[model samples]
Target chain A: MRETESAAEARPYHHGDLRRALIDAARRILETKGPAALSLRAVAREAGVSPAAPYHHFKDKGELLDAVADEGWRILNEAMKAAGENAPSPRAAMPSLGVAYVCFAREHPALYRVMYKRSRDKEALPEHLHEGEDSAYCRTRDTLIAAGADPSDPVGLELATIAAWCAAHGLAEIGGFQQFAHLKEALGGEEAFFRGVFEHMGVFARGLND
Target chain B: MRETESAAEARPYHHGDLRRALIDAARRILETKGPAALSLRAVAREAGVSPAAPYHHFKDKGELLDAVADEGWRILNEAMKAAGENAPSPRAAMPSLGVAYVCFAREHPALYRVMYKRSRDKEALPEHLHEGEDSAYCRTRDTLIAAGADPSDPVGLELATIAAWCAAHGLAEIGGFQQFAHLKEALGGEEAFFRGVFEHMGVFARGLND
Candidate 1:
């Protein structure tokens, strides 16, 4: 009886707000406990909502995870764009973007894993995520094309993009391992270690041109 | 009363065999059901053994996982060595080794994930896995030296090795993703996709020398 007409009108707005809150809660859980611990119920609990509340926003855990991964990609896309835009020249952007990609993974290891984890499950990702033109993958491809890569030859462009991406991804994945601690020390520090790898990117990009 | 001295004598051998079986069972589970499905009890059940049996071989789940990851590295080491040895020349070995690294991951996705997953855990990997001289990481280092990288300059050699590793690892991780399906199709097929990536390795290596 206390719930009046104004409260009813505000219900849809609350629903939208709850969806964002649930995604934020899921991200926190993913960062703290890793992907295995991320469940819709757990997210609801983290967000201080009832167990059934998350279902109104997400159909199941998969949908929630996909949302979290989408958020990760959006943040990553921004980081890569910033790195490219701040660089002095188009060719210089490649190594900056490479460094940024690895640095993003280092900063958000759990989120990085979740972003890539969707690829393992066959049906989880939406069609737009898979499309080359609209994805962060395209950012790398476009950067490569801008940086002296032959835009006309799609095959060559793809190969160059793959090589650059592989190098960045590999470095990011291994950067956090204790086994590589010595490499970091030997190279002076973490920044130096990253710089050394980026130097090789310059060599690699020049080689692509040749 | 029926358990006598002879049965006691047989117990040690059974322990050793069970340990091997548990590792094998864990590998099978990892490959089929993915790493999340891997648990000591699950592995024991998969191997047709008692629930308590795995505890006799591994202290806990972490110990069991480390053992499985160790076995994965052993297999990967052999694959890499075989690839390096089969190449006609020292310089020719780099791209071959790169291809082998990615192919090993492709062939054993779950095990590859486990092998890399150990790097994330702070204390799980054995000391031997960290030894620079004995690891598969060293194989890349050695190949770089063979391909005319200055072995005396450890920093430079390490950087080159990282570059090669990052490229290979990136390709392997994304190779299975549907996002790259169009790229693969454009390259003609899966084999051609791998071949294109390997060809870029040759260019990257040559650039390193210059």
Candidate 2:
């Protein structure tokens, strides 16, 4: 009996581990085939498990996708936090965080798309992740407040935050498109192009402070 | 012979009009089902034509999509131009153009998504629409140059253009997502929310000028 239990544990199918395995498989599918191609059966096939195995963990594809998006937000929040922590000051952290935001989108285009699927139904999002309180959003807002924006003026603060957020998000989405290939080539390479954008972001950030 | 030709034209199967019909059908499908759900057969079915009919007009789905995206850009350029032309001055035109951009995306989410599909291959885009010379992109650049950015400094002009573009693009993309529904509600409604964003863009534009 002891040998059989140890064998089951060593087989990588131990109880409660299937959920994590499914999410990992889903991320792989999302990264490679994109959200449109993702399905529970595909994830199960990628995980080398029976289709019924995923059903045991997720109620349906939406539940599984919600889990994937949840994980994506968590990963993004960590990346933004790390970028802020590594920067020299709150002022510098602003653009660094913006760079990190765009870089995250570039690295995980499919996952990022899935994370922001356009359903127009807020219920589709996981309950714990409120957009206003999202770690990254709050971090950006706090940075703006620290940089001399009037914290008491809610509208002013909101507008400042939106300006910064919009600029970063726009760069990420547009930069991801192929239409800018010529501009990227002219700027030397992708990294060089992003560097130029980041430098401009520094100016935009200072503008916000003023 | 004249009567027969008139009859054929009235039948909605006019020889030269199939391409236009197919494109119109594709737009209906795109607006209803979105880009992910778009397919050649579905477009043909929507047009009440045989499955093979679309092939006569478009070799493949990519060709059809390119056509749809091309139409999207032409419409978007016109919208931006109208917004700029109606504004009182170049500075006023900046935020008007930004508002028009976000409003365009909100009004045509699916078409906008198809127009900016994330293909890293430059060949995917139509050759005529050069990124640097794209009407909307160039218009934004010219507006920035007109707003006091030194035209002599190419890099400065480029960065300023990018900052403005990124902010507008970000607002459009982010506003399309449901996560910001609460923010929209808090600001009163969609128009009110957009008004707030446009107001912020005005401030950011002044910052750029400074």
Highest-lDDT candidate: 1
Residue A193 in candidate 1 has what lDDT? 84
Q: Which candidate has the top score in DockQ?
A: 1
For model 2, the superposed segments whose C-alpha errors exceed 4 Å read: A1-16, A32-37, A118-134, A178-192, A201-210, B1-16, B33-37, B118-134, B177-189, B201-210
Residue lDDT tens for model 2, A158-198 = 77677767777777766765656666888898666765775
Task: Write down the TM-score of every candidate.
Answer: 0.84, 0.82
| Model 2 lDDT, residue B25, Cα | 90
In terms of lDDT, the poorest run of 10 residues in model 2 chain A is A201-210
Model 1 chain A is weakest, by summed lDDT over 10 consecutive residues, at A201-210
Q: Candidate 1 deviates by what RMSD?
A: 4.8
State in Å the error of residue B34, model 2: 4.2
Cα-based lDDT at residue A151, candidate 2:
81
